[model samples]
Target: MLTIVNDFLWGQILIVALVGAGLLFTIGSGGVQFRYFGRMFSVLRRGFHHEQGHISSFQALVVSVAGRVGSGNIAGVAVAITLGGPGAVFWMWVIGLMGMATSFFECSLAQLFKRYQPDGTYRGGPAYYLTHGIGQRGLAIIYSVLLLVTFGLGFNAVQSYVVATSLQASFGVATWVTGLVMVLGLAVVIFGGIRRIAVVSELIVPLMALMYLCAALLVIGMNITAVPAVLGHIVQSAFGLEQAVGGGLGVVIMQGVKRGLFSNEAGLGSAPNVAAVAHVPHPVNQGIVQAFSVFIDTIIMCTCTAVIILLSDVYQPGASDVDGVVLTQTAMAGHLGSWGAGFVSVALVLFAFSSIMYNYYLGDNSLSFFSDENPLVANIFRVLVLALVFWGSLQDLSTVFGFAELTMGLLAVVNLFGLVWMYRIGVRLLRDYDGQLRSGKETPRLRTEDWTDLDIDERAWRD
Candidate 1:
């Protein structure tokens, strides 16, 4: 049943919605993702500066990136190749490109409709936007529940499963031991709230990414002669022009889209939950920053893993027994010897650990929509999340991934529906930001007074 639902969602409904909506948003926004490509860095650089006690835009970005650049980059990429072939990497690239625009709109809307919390913080996401932007309280509730289930429970389980399996494959560590360590570490950080998560992500995300990229670069350097052949094969396999490990073109596309969305989370609506937490002068600023994060995750981080695996001799085109984190681990070991496997295991721990933190925040934020920020309710939710993390370690890969994919598809559908319906408002925010830039302002600021017709939180945006 889970596989059937996932097949329908990934093979039919979601691929169209994700690609079509991304194209629409890209065209509708005048290719804002492209136009602001360089500007994203500038916005991110400025994002480092924030008012005291507020979440800086850069912090918010790393939190979203932490959520994105996890097991999906390493284990998920391996799964794509195992099932979809090298061609799936091409589709992953395609989705990453289109997803940038989709991320921008969703995140901008999140920032726009965000609520001002009494604790001098912000709270918002698709749930807040649905109710506050379109007067749909019931839909908001549904989105909140799905968010809680998808990120809070389903996706976090997937992360735990990946890390546990990777560690067991590499170091002979017991999966149960890994689960307990992860649960204990996660409990300490999550209880500290979003700020601590942000700080930890800020430190770990950059350093870990750099180390992983350097490792990939070393592999690419060693296999410099095969670089052209590997690149050509990925493109050829994507079109079924070459016989490869995965099935036909359909399987290639499906795997790519599924794993790609899983990796970067462009249109999945997960990033917006964190995007809404940033203290930015204009909503579009954070939107641009978030868009850049998708690029970092899929284009940079995921591609590194793909190159490492494909460039390795251990990766046979159609191997059956080797898959998931083990494939990645084996491929790395084949390159850098035994230590290579250890490196991947350590990297997975850091990546998935940060993701657990990011995922916890999303679930906690979603609970706020229903519980009115009740402390007891929040603690209970944390306990449930911790339980899932441990439970995930004992489960098989397929079961955990299938459940996560099903819930993620449902959540994306709801969020995409809201994005399509609220298209014009997204455009207006873009134009307003552009208008300010054209008027010679170095930083575009949101003037809440100008959007009187919209249900924006005035106190949240007040200078």
Candidate 2:
């Protein structure tokens, strides 16, 4: 019964809504993700103009990328390949491309409706916009509660569990040992609050991502002769034309979309929570940055993992026992001998650890909605998240994953509906941003007066 419910939520309902909304945003924004792809790096290079003690646009991008580039990029991609075959990889690319638009609109909206905290930090997400932008407190509260469970407890546990299992598999380490180390590390970063989290993420995310990508490229370089054929297999298999596996087109697309969501988190409403933290002069600036993050997470990081697994001789589709992170570990080992498993174990630790901190920030930001400026609320939630991280390391995989999927599905539905309802605002913001650029402005800063009717925190946008 539980499995059926989760499948319905993730495989059926959420997929349609997620993809449909993404398409809608893509058409609505006139391909903002494509038109301004180059401008994203320019805006990032312009650097941060944040308030005292607040994070810059790049820091927020790093924090968001930290969350997006986690176990999902490694384990989740493996799962997609195992279930959906090489074709699944092609669909993953499609989702990544479309999701860029979804990410842009939602993140820009997050910035538009973000609330300023007393300590000069910013907090916002689907909940803030649902309440202030759509004027529905009930919907906002539900969104917050769902986010609290999905990221704070469920997703964090999943991260810890993946790291623990990978370590146990690769190095004969106990799950409890990994849990203890994870708890200690999580405490130091999460307790220091968002700025500390942002700082650490900025440092670790880039270094770790570069290291993992370099390793993947090394493997791919060695198998350069097989690259073109493997790429062809991915496309053919996606349409049920390849005969290696029997998941059919439906299963292929489902696995690709599901794993893609897990990796990039474009329309899921999670990334926007951190995207709202950046003190960019204009909301679309961070929107573009967040959109670029989707590219990095899915197109670059997840694709790297996909290539690693697909290029390996060890990959066996439809092998029920060899799936998930173990499959990825095996593939890496096939490429680099026994040391590959150890390398992946270390990579998972870094990937999952940064994600746990990023998850805490989302939960902490949600806590602000229910109990404004209340330290106790955030403190209690912090304890709960940490406790779950420890407990998840020891819990069964099915339980943790199922719980995560259920909550995340609900969170996506709520957030996607809000995005669809207020998508015009996204279009309007993009137009406003593009207008400034076309008028010869180098760096476009938003004026609160431009969006007079919206419930924007004027102080946030005021120059």
Candidate 3:
């Protein structure tokens, strides 16, 4: 039943909605993602500078990246290849490209409608935007609930299961032991609140991503001669020119879209929860940074995993036994010997741990939408999240992934509809930033007065 619903959602509904909204956002934003590609790096440099009590743009970005570059980059990529062939990788790239624009719009709107908290932080996401931007409190509640289920419960479980399985495969550790250890470690940071989550993600995300990329580079260099052929195979398989897998083009496209969205979460409404927390000069600046994160997550990190797997001789087109993180680990071990598996296990632990922290923060944020930051409610929510983490570690891969995908698909549907409905507001925010830039402002600050007609919290943008 779970698989049936996920297949329909990913195949029929989400594929069209995801692609269509991405294309629409791309056109509506006047190709902002491309036009400001270089500007993204510049903005990121400034991101290191932020108000003392608030989160830096860089910290927010890394937290969001932590959430994105998790099991999806490793296990999910392997699954895509196993089920849809090399052609799925091509479609993943396509979604990454299109998702950049969608990310820009959604993240910008998040910043635009973010609320200023008394604790000297900001809070917002699709829920805040749906309520404050469009006056849709009911829709906001629905989005918050979906977000809570998808990230807080669903994705965290998936992450825990991936990490637990990876450890078991590499170190021969019992899954239950790994689950207990993970639960204890997660409880430490999550209990410390969002600032601690930001600090941990900041320190871990860059280091882990860099190390993983270096390992992937070594593997690609070892198989440099075969690189061109592999690239050609992906393209050919994508178009059904090469029958590498029996599923054909539809399956190839579906797998890529699903895995790609899972990896980067560009338009899935997940990243915006952290994107709203950044103290940037303009909302679009954070949006640009978030857009670059999608690039990093998919184009850089996920491609590294895909290339590593495709380059390894262990990866057969239809290998059912070796799938998920095990496939990735086997491919790594084949490339660099036994120690390679250990390296992948360590990397996955870091990746999935940070993702769990990120997932917790998103869930906590959503809980606030209902409980208004009540300590009892927050603590109860945290306990539930930890319980799910433990439960997920004991579950099989199919169970965790299926549940996460279904809930994720539903979350995306609501957020995408809200994004499309509130498209003009996103555009206006972009134009405001663009106009300031054109006027030669070094860093364009959002003046809330310009948006007096909207329900924006002026305190968030106060000078």
Candidate 4:
């Protein structure tokens, strides 16, 4: 079963889908992420502004980041290092740089195509962009179904399992206990819709990320001298030039690309769900914000984790394997002792909890993508998500984590296709946006092909 599952995940289709689409997006937009790297920080530091959409840009970014900066940054990186080797970190950096452009393109299209719903809110995503940009109803349906399957079931289950397992180990609690707490919390936030999700994410994601980053920083600072050797090992191992603490170059590259992309999810189409709700003059404004989000997730948050592990130097030249949250805990223990373990446990709880809540919202949107929402189906999916939490807790690492990663990769393929289909729209939007940037105009309306043709009077927008 594991072989079949792993094979199913590692097959040609997913590889082509993820790699091809990613490369295509990078080339399509002239490597926009690379060009815009330095500018991303200026955009974020400017903070949220008042616009005409449902939420502020920062809130939208926060909600999206809530999903991206997940346990994958911590445990996921460990998994990458375990399989792909130290050089995988370099691949991750490649993914982060390229994925930002993909993210920018897709999210810009989402904002461009979004519908102002009858309830004075917004609704859109890969489904909307695929339908609106490509005029492929069938494509939208297929993408929505895949997103629902992957986000609602596969990723949700993985997140719950991580939470439950960590809690059981740390606090000696029942797995079900953690699942229920997550389920109830998720239900409450999601029921309020995008606005509520935005507010909650903005408040919680920053607080949790800051606390965790601060702790990791202190540990890294204490052992700052080891940084050079650690980096040297990463470089040497990446080229197969030397044997560092990690294992395989191919696997590491794949792992870094995998986790880095997973962490920020720029091209994966997940962030656009929240992006569609933001009120901004130009779609690129949100795109800029999303780019900043990638920096925060990988360049800042994941780097902190990596640095701490390196600084601690917990792994001996020949020690039994320790990966995932355990590896992180082990590294921290080298510095803070038992307190390090406790810290990661607490971090996992918050990280997984925030992530699960965001995933639930994604599932909810995905459910709505079917046209009509069914209370029965929604409730059932929620229950299954919670049940999978227990299932994840009980399963062994190889089986459960591999299964989850496979599902995530598959689902990401679906989302990436939808985004890739909308590339033309993004280009045109950016063209107009670039014009405005050059002109320095106070009236910063986006460039549109046919402003009057917009679905402006969309129910709540009944002009």
Candidate 5:
């Protein structure tokens, strides 16, 4: 029943809504993502701005990236190629481009509606805005619960399962052992607090991404002559009128859009959880940074994974028996020998580890909305998370993935409503931010009084 529902949601509803929302926001924002694309780096260069309850913009970037760029980039891309064929890669790119806009709007709205905790930390997300901005407590509660289930629990299980599978395949280790090790490591970080998670993400996200990209570069360099042909093949397969290249056009579009959404999560409403926690002068700045995250995840890391697999002899389109992580591992090993598999196992550990932590923070943030004063709620959740890690490590790949898709699709549909409902505020915030940037100031700050109509926390932006 769950699988059937997810198939319809992902295939018919979400595929359309996801792409449509992204394109809609892209137009409504005056293509701010592209217009201010160069400025994204400038904001990032300004770096961490320490505040009482907020994280630095760069720290937010890494934490969000930790969630965005994960086992999905590696395993998910392989799944797209296997089920959807090479054409899926093209669709993934399309979604990534449009998703930049969706991410910007959602993150901007999150920041705009953010509230402060008594402990001085920040809190906000689709739930916060749905209640505060639109005055819909029921909708807010629904979104919070959906977020908790989808990312906090379901997605964490998927990450653990992916890494556990990779380690098992590469080193002949027991999955239970991997699960035990993962639980211990995760318990230490998640129990340490959100800042500790941010600190770990800051250090690990960049290092792991660079190492994997470098390895991919080596593989691509070795097959330099075939690079142009592979690009042409991807384009041709995507639009091929016939069954010349694997899964035809329909499968291509479906797999590409689905996996791309899973990997980049631009329209999925997950990034805003971390984005809203950033200490930025303006919400639009963090929006841009989060938008940039879409590019990094899909355009860079995912593309690398696709190239490595497609360039190697290990990948065969329409191979139903192919293991997603194993396909990627085989591709790497094809070029780097035995050490390649080892490297993939290690990379998956790092990528999935940071992702698990970020995923926990997202869930932890959602939990706060329900029980701001209940420490026991958080403690119970921690135990549940650890238990899921072990249980997921031992579960079958098909079941874990199916459950993840169902939860994530539902989460996306709920959050997309919040984005479309709050569209005006997002645009207004963007315009105000642009106006400040164009005013020739070294630093631009948002003034809450300018928009007294919206229910913004005035103290958050007060200088």
Candidate 6:
């Protein structure tokens, strides 16, 4: 079943979907992630002000970051290294880099096109952006359903699995116990809604990420002298130019791309859902916040994971018994002993725990959109999500992760296609933002009725 789902998920269909969307976005956006990378911090400053949106720009970005930066950076990194060797890390880099433009463009579209409420709130994402941006409501419905299943149910469930697996591996906890505890915990947060999720993420994401990176980088820095050679090995192995054992060029490239996409979720259209809710004056403003998200998730966090693996020299042949987080722990243990393994156990729990809340809120908001704010439908989605928490925690997580990956890969291909159509819109928005900056404008407004008709997120303007 696992192989079959993976075959379908990573099949030629998804391969085309994943790569085609990113490639198209890369060309269409003029490589915006890198072009705008230096400006992200400044743009992010907009998040500091209170706004009229659902959440602060920083809060929304962090909420999405909480979701995107989870097990993928940790266990997912180990999986990529285990299967693809060091060369795979190179492919992951390509995805994170190229994927950011996709993320920025999508968030820009979502922001520019979202629907605002009379109560000074907003709602948008693939459904709103695809429908409004592409002028196709039908396709938007299709996209929403896919997202509902994928990110809402599928990814959240996978998060539970990572928690269960990590606990089982490191602490000998039963999967049932893991599932029940998580279900109860997730239920509490999901019931609290996006604001609560944002708050929790604001607290947990920074601390967990800081702790994880500090631990990983300590190991990487210790092996700093071996970094160059390890990078060489990764490059040579990626193309199978150096001849890896029991795998070919396909395995090498796919592992990195798969894990990397899972890491930052730039092109996957998931983060933009949260990005749509962030309170920013301009669409591109949120885009910059998202651009930094990709860099942080992959370049900083996942790179740390890759560095530790490389430095530990664990990509050696026939190393299949240890994979995922265990592989990462082994690498850490080699450098830091048992204490390092303890850190992995704690980090995975926190990372996966935070992701559960992120996914739950995303799913809830998505359902609210679909139901046109019908309370009944909203309640059902929440109930179903809580139910899945137990199902996911106890059951094998790879099942849900596999399905979610397929859904995300499909959405990226479909959504990126639509994003290409928004190029003219992006140019106009960017020009508008630049004009404001040039005018030495302390405060900028979205001059278009198009912006007002959609969601009005002006929290950045609040005191």
TM-score of each: 0.96, 0.97, 0.97, 0.88, 0.96, 0.90
Each model's backbone clash number: 0, 1, 0, 6, 0, 7
Any runs in candidate 5 off by more than 4 Å, and if so which? 241-247
Instruction: Kindly report which residue stretches of model 3 are placed more than 4 angstroms away from their true locations once superposed.
Output: 397-401
Q: For residue 268, give model 4's deviation from the true position in Å.
A: 2.4
**Model 2 lDDT per residue over 211-305, tens place:** 99999999999999998998898988988887456757888888898889878988889999998888888899989999999999998998899
Question: lDDT per prediction?
Answer: 0.90, 0.88, 0.89, 0.72, 0.86, 0.76
Inter-residue clash pairs, candidate 1: none
In candidate 5, the residue pairs with backbone N, CA or C atoms under 3 Å apart (3 or more residues apart, or in different chains) clash, namely none
What's the true lDDT of residue 150 in model 2?
83
How well is each residue in 82-146 modelled by candidate 4, as lDDT tens digits? 66666666667667767777778778777777776656677778888777776777877776776
Instruction: Report the lDDT of model 5 for residue 271.
Output: 91
In candidate 5 the C-alpha lDDT for residue 283 amounts to 89
TM-score of candidate 2 relative to the true fold: 0.97
**Candidate 6 clash pair list:** 50-459, 51-458, 51-459, 52-459, 86-234, 87-234, 114-455
Worst 10 residues of 4 by lDDT: 454-463
Native-structure RMSD, model 4: 3.2
What tens-digit string does per-residue lDDT give for candidate 1 at 177-279?
9999999988888998888889889999998889899999999999999989999999999999985753678888888988898789887788999999889
Best by TM-score: 2
Q: If both were scored by lDDT, which would come out higher, candidate 1 or candidate 2?
A: 1
Q: Least lDDT summed over 10 consecutive residues: which range in candidate 6?
A: 454-463
Show where candidate 2 strays beyond 4 Å: none
Estimate, for each residue in 119-188, the C-alpha lDDT of model 6 and write its tens digit.
5667788778777776777877777778888878898777777788788888899988998988787777
Error of 2 at 364 (Å): 0.6
Please list the Cα RMSD from the true structure of every candidate, rounded to 1 decimal place. 1.6, 1.3, 1.5, 3.2, 1.6, 3.1
Error of 5 at 431 (Å): 0.8
Candidate 1: how large is its RMSD?
Answer: 1.6
